[model samples]
Target: MKFSVFQLSRRGARARNEDRIGYCYTREACLLVLADGMGGHAAGDVAAQIALNSVCALFQARATPLLDDAPGFLAEALLHAHRQILRHAQQHHLADAPRTTLVVALLQQGQAWWIHCGDSRLYLARAGALLARTRDHSFRAMAERSGQPPASVNRNLLFTCLGSPSLPISDQAGPWPLARGDRLLLCSDGLWDALGETELLALLAHDPVSLCVPRLVDRALQHTGASSDNVSAIALEWEMPGAQSAPDSISTDALEGDAFESTLQLDAPDLPEPAPPVPALPEDELSEAAIERTIAEINAAIRRPGERRR
Candidate 1:
């Protein structure tokens, strides 16, 4: 399989960039990761950097050799990072425990495996349609699944995450067989919460990550009024010169278009008034609950089964 990878990070309207770190590496296969740090000042940044560094370092040192068990290897790496983050938080007397959201993707032999925690996301797209996405570990998600109006759930509650000693760590990894022309996106909540999958597909269809990354971040900043949070995104595209067309291509396009138009229509009724741009929250004001709520909604949307309808 032939593949291309790209990543981008930006401090959007924030006094300090809290967005931590991201990485993409291709050896016998490809691995991509995105981590969004949570904490005050440089603490969040430190946590995120450490998480990514630790995971990548472990994968290189111990996991790469076990390519046949990439899913298990990646899961173990994530758990290792979680423990390391907790250790660092304790070592330093940070006012807030340093924590982060992590998303990882491993693609090998026309198959992919991924694991995630918190609100960070992993999206798989083929022929302009999202094939699968990871669910967020947040209270809002749990409530909605148990039959609550998603809109009624408070957005600021996380049921699980990294860095919290009490948060349950999940090593559940999703494995899917891939084909040529498949794309994988890993992003922080700062980006995915602002740009829905429809918009994401449209953007990716237009260009590779080198262009899509900045465009997505720009849209988020523009729509959110340049919120101070750091935004990071990593995209991987798999293309084979003569691979067969994806079976879901046609239906996926229809579904993607319908979803896009619906969102546009919903936003349209409230448009034309030239509403003021929403400002990005201050680092101190960042509400994990609100981000978690958005993530819950996304998880639900991805889980719903139907033809891509416009």
Candidate 2:
């Protein structure tokens, strides 16, 4: 199988774009990684960079071409990234460590295996429909899933992430067989949270992987407007040249429990929770336009001369 890939990021009226994205591949295996820095904390970009770099380093050191155990590599790599964040915090004497949400996907031997910490997401689209996606590890999401009281809560309060004093917990999924035209999208909340699931599926289904990603980011930025956080995404298509079209999208019946693989948590001393819930993005940083008004401005900005250069 051959793969086509594209990635993009924009500051989107924020002071600094803290989101990061990249991928690594060998002849027989490939890995895709994405992260969203926790903006309420100090040096969030630092945490994001460290997290990506640490994982890449491990990938480089391992046996290339093919992994003996893709899931095991992913789990251990994420844990190592957690430790690197802790070490950075100690070295800098940060009162609160920089934190980030991460998602990683490994493709090898005709199947895909993946893991995520916090809310960054990975979505798989096949044959014009949504096949699977990650569920956020946030308090509000947990509450919604549980069908319990207090459903209205801050969706930004994540229960797990790298660089917190507490041990990080990550959920893993997949080993799902890939179809020739299967499309994978890995993105920060800035991208997925801003767009509806149906809209996203449409883009993935119809547009070429290269074009769909940039348009998605552009729409997301306009949808969120000035209040938009850093927007970023990776779009990948597994194209089996000269092959017949893929089968229909995964069925709801057969998809049951197939999307979630497992979870891993390392041993670490418990840390006290912060008094104030952390902001997914700083309130003060991107204040020019709230998401509601962004579309009009985006259109106007596009119509003006030389405005697109900015």
Candidate 3:
């Protein structure tokens, strides 16, 4: 597969950036991920970093060339990442677990698959039109879609996220066929919250991802100036031929069967190193009874009241 990809992040007015973004590819598959750490919790950046590390590590191990089950892999990977965040909180004895919104897209064999938790998003555009976009997990978003009154709903408050006490709820989509020039963007809410859909579609539809990503990020930062959130985005244009390529083009045709390439990074010196990759669960460990029990636990947790509604 051949594509052009680019990613960008800005700290904006925040003291530190809590958003993270990256992509990795094997000979037959590519993984794109973005996480927006919830500022309401401590170590938000650490949570975002852990999410990226956990998922990419698992992808590296499982995608020897390509995933056996892309959608299944995404589901298991999200739960694994959630567990890792909880483990981090336990290890550090934090008052509350760090939380983050996560979005991931997997491209392989001429199709795309994605999964997301919380407000981070993935947008698929084709020929100057918005083909699809992930729905946010916030109460305001839910209200808008369900035709419920949204009075007093906080736009930033999400109902679920990784690292919360309850199991996170996530949405999965795809197996969508990719046509040449299809563009997929995975981004933190920071970028989308500041820019309208029309603006994003226009930018993504006309330019190479490398140029589009920078312009999109810059516009977001400028729009929210002085109080902008940590803006981050990662995008790709499907199957752009080498002849028409911009500097960011990548072709996986030459990679060996075992080769892997990634841009995920862990650079903060203060944060502890990420834990080892989560191994796939044994059949017995994932028995039907155990699954039901876990669901019951999550239901109980969700029903319980909190200091403030997420």
Q: Candidate 1: TM-score? A: 0.71
Question: In angstroms, how far off is 117's CA in candidate 2?
Answer: 0.4
What's the alpha carbon RMSD for model 2? 15.4
Over the stretch 1-310, how does candidate 2's per-residue lDDT look in tens digits?
3677767777777888787776655456667888788998998887886777666545544523467888898998898778878877999888988999999998877788899999999999898688889989999889988886645778889999999989888999889899887989999888888999988788777756778888998899889997987888887787563454334211112222212111111111111111111111122332223321322332233234431110
Q: What is the lDDT of every predicted structure here?
A: 0.60, 0.70, 0.81
For candidate 1, what is the total of clashing residue pairs? 11
Which should have the higher TM-score, number 1 or number 2?
2
Q: Candidate 3 clashing pairs? A: 158-310
Query: Tens-digit lDDT track for model 1 on 1-310?
Result: 3565666666776655555444433234556767777643346666675667566545444423235588777777787777777766778776556777777787666678888887788888888887888877777877777887788776546666677767545645566887766788887777877777788778876565567667887787677784535667777777663555433222112222112111100011112111111122223432434433332343243345444321
Among these predicted structures, which one has the highest lDDT?
Answer: 3
Give the per-residue lDDT of model 3 (tens digit) for 190-281.
89999999998998888688888989989998999998998889899998444465556789889876576666533222222222222332
Top-TM-score structure, candidate number: 3
Model 1, residue 160: C-alpha shift (Å): 1.4
- Clash count for each candidate, listed in order shown: 11, 0, 1
**TM-score of every candidate relative to the true structure:** 0.71, 0.77, 0.84
Per-candidate RMSD, Å: 15.6, 15.4, 9.4
